[model samples]
Target: MSSHVKLRKERGTIAECETQVKEIRSQMAEQLKSLDLHVEMRVQLLQDLSEFFRRKAEIETEYSRGLEKLAERFSSRIRNSKEPQHSRKEQDLLSSVSCWHLILNHTRQESREHAVLSDTYSNSMVVRLCHITEDTGRLSKKSKDIGLQMQEQLLKVTSELQTAMKTYNQYHTDSMNAEGKLKEVEKLEERHMGKSADPGLGQSGVDAKQQRSSTLKKMERLKEKRQAKFLENKLKCTKARNDYLLNLAAANAAMNKYYLQDVCSLIECCDLGFHLSLGVTLRLYLSAQSRVQQSQQEAVGVLEGAVQGLDPPGDQKKILEMNHTAFCLPFRFEYQPHEGDQVCVVSAEAQVRNELVTRFQQLQSRLSSVSLETEEVNKTMKATLKALLDSFSFEDFSSSDSLQTSQSAESVKSSGSDPPGNKPNIAKRRANQQETESFYFTKVKEYLSGCSLISKLQAKHDLLKEAIEKAEGIDSDPSRLQCSNRSLRVRKQRPCSQYNHKLFTGDLQQFVESSGQLIPLVVESCIRFINLHGLHHEGIFRVPGSQSEVNEIRNAFERGEDPLTDLTDHNIDSVAGVLKLYFRGLEKPLFPQEKFQELVECVQIENKLERACHIKKVVGCFPQAVLIIMRFLFAFLNHLSQYSDENMMDSHNLAVCFGPTLVAVPLDQDAVSVQPRVNEVVKTIIMFHEKIFPGARELEGPLYEKCMTEEEEYW
Candidate 1:
């Protein structure tokens, strides 16, 4: 029973203890709550204090207004009093009583509120203190964190500063060493002994070397050209020497066979076989005297033969009649003065006239294939006229001549008139004839005048003037006479003014003949010329068709034969030859300036070329304008081709010297105008190129490609 009770008591005690602990914990919670409650009460007190202060400020303002009103009322009363007997103390006492009541009441309110305010301020002060303590802990933590970060940054900056210090020290040492070295080098350079290179010496040496090379090259070229020229000259000299020897032998042979006497005798021969092929021109008049002697001798011989045969054959009378008929036959066939035979020797001799005629043609073929001019040859015909003259002069001396017949008539009457027809034979015939009457060659002398030398020379000049006037014109100047197919120019005997209104005119052949056709006329003119001048006879004379065949043809013309038709059919030609001689061009002009001289020479060369072309064109044209135009076209084209070739040569030279850029080529439009000048420049370049490299040709294809690749420039 005791134990049970004891356990109950213990349990009760334990329960009490446990209750106390719970209450204690509750009490602690209440204490914490009371602390929170104190903070809340403090906050509420602060709020009430602020409210009370605001209300107190308002109460003070009202109290001040009441005091102002009260003072104002008292001052007004005092000032308005009539006697002003109130004591200053009494007024002061009344004003003080009112203030005492207001002060006591204000003091009571303030006392009442001062406790609440004091408590509120005390609580706020305690809370502020606790906040300050918490803030101090927070600032301490921030300071620790900031101090650690700053220390790390400062260590990094210290490392960088150490590197910069090391670099600055090294730079200082280097600067000091460099300054010392600069001073030492300056001293060494000032004491140097070696010489510096000269500026111009190397250039002079190069020029000297170039000059030597050029001289050596020139010597080589000169040697080669000399060899070539020597060989060429030697060949020409050898050919000239052989030609000279051959000509000498031929000339000697010709000289040995010449004889003047045989020529005279041969002229009288009847044989026509002795042709003139020995390459000597025959003088046509050389056979005239021999011919006259032969004819006279033949006549005398015939007379002698007839006399010797005087027995008189069966047909002597008939033969005499035949001889008389034969003598008159010449007169019956005699050529008249017009259209008989006339041919110009000048036109025949022209070179251009020989297109179909070979240059090697015989002289006789060239001159005598044609006859002499008709009017002159017909009127003066030598053989026929001579025959007439001879017959007229000698007939008077013949046995049956008229002069002898008169003598016979007188004698016959004196012999007592013969029986009607009773005439003696030869003896009686002689007895009846009287002495011969005189008739001499004095008749021939009356028909002739002037010496023979003057006459022949006059005839030749007359013939020349006639020919010149007839074939070309009367122009005294050769240059003025240049035209095609012009006929002979024949002038009036006297200038037109001398003939009044009648102009003298005739055909070319007749005009020349009007001067004179008599042999005596020609002979007399020749005689006058001979007396005037002391020229050798052979030196100034030229007779046409001097060969035998030509003479026979001339004799045939005297007997009334027409010759022009035969001549025109057999041998004639037309020619167009330009005169090449120019006196002015031959005397080349001189110029003092070398450049001017060169330019003049160049111009002259060009002019000569053009003139040559013109001359060739004129010759080629002959008698046709179309032919002249064609020739001009071809000639001008040839000149253009030559100009083009020169252009190419210049281009090649330019290409070699100035690279391809400066080649002597002109652009499309510029080419037309500057071609001539460009050609000149190119010509100059080519000359220089040849000077640089003789016998040189253009650069090869690969070389050309390389050169042109440098850069092409258009001029």
Candidate 2:
């Protein structure tokens, strides 16, 4: 019984201990709950961060793609364009095609860098962040599971302890009740034993005694049963108390372990690891960004270097060097007037006289105006200089101004109210000097401009005066008239003067009759040689031959030598130049001046077939010799135009080269003003040679056979 009582007393202390442990379990569970919430928030944050990086990477990739496309589009345009990339006048930085190409290249490089950055963000930064989020979530779930399990374990032990305590209390109450019933039964029996025996009524007393004995037996039996019951209950109470105490100790130990080690470990793993991993992931992201920025900086540096390296002059020089042949100067118009026309002769002389007089009067007027302007500028410059000089003391203004000006500057410095080192006075003097110098320079610039203008006018005046004197001399000289008539008399007299060479500048009919061929030998030989060797030559007639070589070939032809027979020793350009020079030196152009307007008007017809017919009719009006040569030359030109890709001389280019030479205009007409029409006529002739000259024979076989037959007939 005493053990049972002591057990019950210890049970209350154990329950108190369990209650304290339960409080610890609650604290540990709350801590774990808070930790789980923090981990969840952190995971969400990391997920958001990963998504942000992913979006940024996507944007960067898209931007990079756009930049690449922009670069490629411009690059393709530059590559495919036929026009020159740079203009001759655009001689500044960034004007070269190379600079533009470099800029495109830089853009492409930048795109590549951006693409790399995108890749880094996607593959390195974003991926790392996602991995961190995954790991943090995984670890947080694991920690939360462990924490819940620990709390459940503690709570389960605590529930078992409570049930054990309840069983112990119930057993203890039954044992105490059984003990009280036994004590009550024993007190009743003692009272019965203490009662005296009364023999008053023998029979009643006997019956009473028997009843009291039976009662005593029953009471004793009940007392014995109660005592046994009390012992059993006390044993059960002790066992229950022991179980409750054991469970209480277990719960307490579990709670202590959870709060002390398990909970701390869970918090450490979840909270510290989460923070550390997050920081590492963020650092990795920053590193990736830094690498991207570094790469961007490198790209920018390279772009800046390319920009700094731009050299417009060097690029222009390189372009010129590469395309020098294509830059050959075009042919100039050579004036070739027609002969044997009295009306043309009178009109030419009158035109020359009027032109010379008009030019002389204009030059005289310009020279006077320039001279007066120059005088005014000189006077203004002198007045400005004199005014500047009079501000200082000088004995001789012309020679001593510089010295006196220096002295005056020193004197002003010494006489100033401020000290010698006064900065304000110095600045004021500098400003005044700058103003004075600016005024002087302005006057000097005006004077120099006036001088340049006067000098140019004087040169024009001199040239005009010389032209007037020469024109007057020609008008007064009888020799000029003889020279003018020399071409007409050349057929009868056959003058051999240098100016009247029989083979060159001679009558085309005379040459044909003399050579006993339909075409002159010079024209035939030049055309045959060019057809054999120079047809595919670049720039053919557009690029002129050396003057000395051309003159030598011309002299040989004029001297009646067949210089073109062995053209292996001659340049193709010189041979072509000889042909052009022969036509330009002709006393009459292939197209006569009298029919020039009619030919031009025919070319103006809007319809192509009608224009060709009209031009053919007008061309047929020429002498047979003219018609045959025109047919031969145009046929050859049409052949040359077929190789226009190689020679760079199509019908238009060839016509520009030969228009002024093959066609003649009246002296009263400006050759420049009439050149476009002439070029159009020549181009039309070349393009429509077969249609214009319908019966023209093949240049190789039939033409040579016709030439042979004609030569035989002439012989």
Candidate 3:
């Protein structure tokens, strides 16, 4: 009975101990789980804090850079203005007005910092909660060491949280203070703006307004003075005009009084004589002639009386008495008649009459002196006449000229009848006939030559007309042509075609059309120029065509014929090659490859607006030839796209065919070296086509890929 009681009690005790151990283990596990959750939260909060710091630094740097850029832009605008000093002053005023902007920015920065700190503080609380969770596992294992370390870490975290909170509160206060200052600054700036808006009001006192008032007063005075001067000048001009009129009238009166005497005398003479009606100009002219004739008659009478003995005046006296008439010259002034004026006219006439009488007396004295000389001349003339009569011979005076001419001819012929002096008449006639025949033959030869030239010119004109018709027909056809075509292509192949078979037969027609139909003719002309100038050395630069054929083609071109249709494959290729040669001879390339690369880079800017601006800047610097070539390539690509749609050569095929050929590459450099450049240019050209014709399909093909890859490999 004693043993059973003991066993029962022991079992009860053991159950109690087991129950206690289970409760303790459950509590510790719960604590450990809570600790782990706190640790994870702390770690995440620390990471977030680090990220916030990084973002804050980035924002600050970006803000600073943006501020500097804005300032530079404003400064540049001010400096570039036409009024530098005035603009600078305005810039200063603007800066003063914008002072509030800086304050606002500072306030905003402070607010942001405060917000970030407040967030850090809030997150630090979660970290602090991690420390409150006890780590019982450390209490069990190395209890003192683990507990002390956990306490130290917890203290450190708590201290950092406290520091962050303090900083947050400080930033919050600063933000509020800055915001208050920003308001004050804005109020001050507003007042300054109002004051500046009024031109009459200035910070430099009222000096500017006062100066403007003084300048206005001076301008009013100056205007009044100018008006007065103008009036004085007008008065002077009026007085001078009146003086000129008076002088003109006086001069007219003087001219009529002195110079118009002939007119007055003519009027009087007409009235005094038989008054015949006549035109004024005719009467004046006839009156002057009559006066001159009267003077001439008086002088002639005196001379006749002095030179020869006079016959008695019988029938002439009677005829003169029958036609006797008298005329008088009236003296009159243009204005009021002056007594002295008439006296001057009467005295002048009287002087003339007295002079005439004195001249006649002198003539009579001279005639008496010359009378002896006249008698001597008459006696000599009579003796000469007698000698002439004694020496005259009147025999055979009635004979005809023909009879005399025949007699003279016979005498000359008989005189030349000697062997040395007289050759056979037949031989002389033969020589004359030979000379005449040779001259006529020479003239005939010249006429035949001229006729041949005219015929050749006419044939050329006919050929040119035929060529025009042929070219028109070819142009009318829509089908593309090839060297192998039987009807359209030339049948006769030249030696040059065999040697340059690839070039001659290549598809160069697309690029050649834009240059002109005369490109081949120009090339031939250049080749001729080269040969004539000795620019072509043997085997160095030989043009590939028979000389005669080239000359004929060139002549036809000079005659304004379109010879494009007449050009064979061989000639076309030769001309295309020459075209390239001409480009190579230029001092600078048409499109510099280096500059094109820069242009591509410019257009490749990421920003669309910036890219457009850069494109304008770059394109503006391009040479004229480059611009033209770019336009041509753009057109070529558009046409090529159409050609592709029509099942002709596609974009890639055309690019491959003509891209490198269009741009002149130096022979010293391999074609492979510039193949990529040409391909890029071709792609750019296609892009331009897309821009011009937006509805067109984009370029695509395996051939394009192949070409691009080939070019890329070269690079």
Candidate 4:
């Protein structure tokens, strides 16, 4: 049942009504107190929420500021950079520049969005919540005030009722006391009359009668006073009772109104006002957050679309097209005669012969000096090795005179004759000898490296001499000289060929003879190109070139055109591929087919010195042209391999790439079966080119001895 119905059924007497009123008032007061506390708690919650949003706004503002600064910093750097934006060094990054710029733009946009979000949280959400808190708090305070006023009015009525009840009880008690006194006096008078009726003791009776008469008079007066007091007390008590009844009724009515209407209205107002304002404020918060989220979502979608639309190749092509002038082919150099010698026709053949003779003479002098140094170094190394060996044993000193001339030999003989306790000295001497041996080996490597240098110089020397001889031979023949002069004139006038002339698929010897070069022109050109441009290129020989570019370069070379002279349009790999293609298409492999097995067997020898010697012997059987080309090519390869850290093509990798191209196999033999041996032979030749080729006689003692030890370990 409802509280109102229950209160109505429980209301019986004034006391019961008052008791019920007290309980209802107590309950309502507690509820009001609870409502006040709840209001305060809600207000505090709203304050805390506002503080949270305020802090969030601060954090977002800071984050947005940081993002803006970051984007601005990078964009400024990109703008202020001094280097070309699309140079070759930056080509790889050029395609992504637009994407990076897009990211920066979107990041700035996101910063703006966050700034707006911060404003929303600080101005919109927080403001609305504060308003709601204020409204709820004001409503709660007003409701509490109204409830307190009603409660105070009920207390006033209850206090009046208590005072009236006290007055009525006091009056009734005074009236009852008076009535008892009057009744007691009447009983005494009746007892005195009975005594006067008796005959005995006349005088005492007369005295008693007199006393009784006086007492009667006194009793009559007292009765009259008592009767007056009783009537007045009765009237006063009736008035007091009437006032008590009126106050009780008034108190009951006041309490009933308070519990039934006032308290209920106050509680409902507080609850409804607080909840309504809270609901509105929360809805505002949600709406603001949703709007911010929707904005951010749209921004993110746009950013995603931009990110997804990035096209690297298209960007690269566009950049290339825009910078076309930067990539134009450089002009060729033209001959310019001296200012005053325009008509002075110089004999080209005589000029060429003089240049050749000068180079040959220079190389010849260098060879003589280098040969003398090699002999000196060889002598020193042999002496060091012999001293090291002789220090260990005295028996090798065949004569006592030799032992007497050597300190180490004398020490060995003395130690051999000494007691067993002197073996430590002998051991110490042997350790010193071993140390000397190590030093000897170090010098031997130096000597061998010198020999290798001499070999290279010797090769250049021989090439220059041949050119000079060829020039001299042409000069010696009058008929050949006239033909050469006429042909040279026609060649200078001839235009470059446009069609392929089948230069690659020819015999190596034939190409060398036709070009009057120790090595083919194609080989020389490719080697020069790689040396100039691709020595430090990673995976120089292993990485495949673009097939179309390789074919284009190959056709140009086959037409006797110098495609490699201007290499801006070609990559290093393409030129390397052309070189490999020329060798692959050769009519006869550089190493003759019949010699393939012998070379393979020599490479497989167990002793490194013997293996190198045998391989050198077999390589010696090749023609002079072949030897010259091998020296040229392997010399270039050895130099190139020194840059293995950058190019990643060491001797092993080069051998693997060129083994099949340079070495020939018999038809009866499976190329796959002997493939490992072929690569081994080529690797050995490249590594031991200084040893295998006859350049310096210094390879006999210490050089070959060190080779036997160190190269054995290397193999």
Q: Kindly provide the TM-score of model 2 when superposed on the true structure, using C-alpha atoms.
A: 0.32
After superposition, candidate 3 runs with Cα above 4 Å error: 1-562, 565-587, 600-617, 645-648, 657-659, 662-674, 687-715
TM-score of 1: 0.15
Which scores higher on TM-score, 2 or 3?
A: 2
Q: What is the model-wide C-alpha lDDT for candidate 1?
A: 0.29
Alpha-carbon lDDT of model 3: 0.36
lDDT of 1 by residue, 244-292 (tens): 2222222222212111111111111111111110001011111211232
Cα lDDT for residue 398, candidate 2: 14
Please write out the lDDT profile of model 3 over residues 1-715, one tens digit for every residue. Answer: 8435644554444344345334433433443343344345534644564455446545644553554455556656656878768665666567764684565444443333333222222332222222212111221222222323323332333243333323333333343344455555556545544554566646565886565556556655655555555555434333332222222233333223212332222222112111111111123222322332455776655554433332223322332243222111112212211111121111112323344334334433443334434444444333332322222211111111111112222332222122231223224433433333333333333332233223322332333333333534544321122335554432222111112111222223322344332223333333333222222121112223345555554444444443433333324324334434444433444455556556446534556455545555555465533444444334534443443432223455445445554554556644543554454455455545434321213221111111121012110
Pairs that collide, model 4: none
Per-residue accuracy of model 2 over 295-322 as CA lDDT, tens digit each? 5776556654554454434543443354
Could you tell me how far off, in angstroms, the CA of residue 342 lies in candidate 2 after the best superposition?
Answer: 99
Using lDDT as the yardstick, the better of models 1 and 3 is 3
User: How well does each candidate superpose onto the true structure, as a TM-score?
Assistant: 0.15, 0.32, 0.18, 0.31
lDDT of 4 by residue, 391-427 (tens): 4332211111111222232243342232333334344
lDDT at position 339, candidate 1: 15
CA RMSD, predictions in order: 78.4, 51.1, 66.2, 53.5
| Clashing pairs for predicted structure model 2, backbone only | none
Give candidate 3's TM-score.
0.18
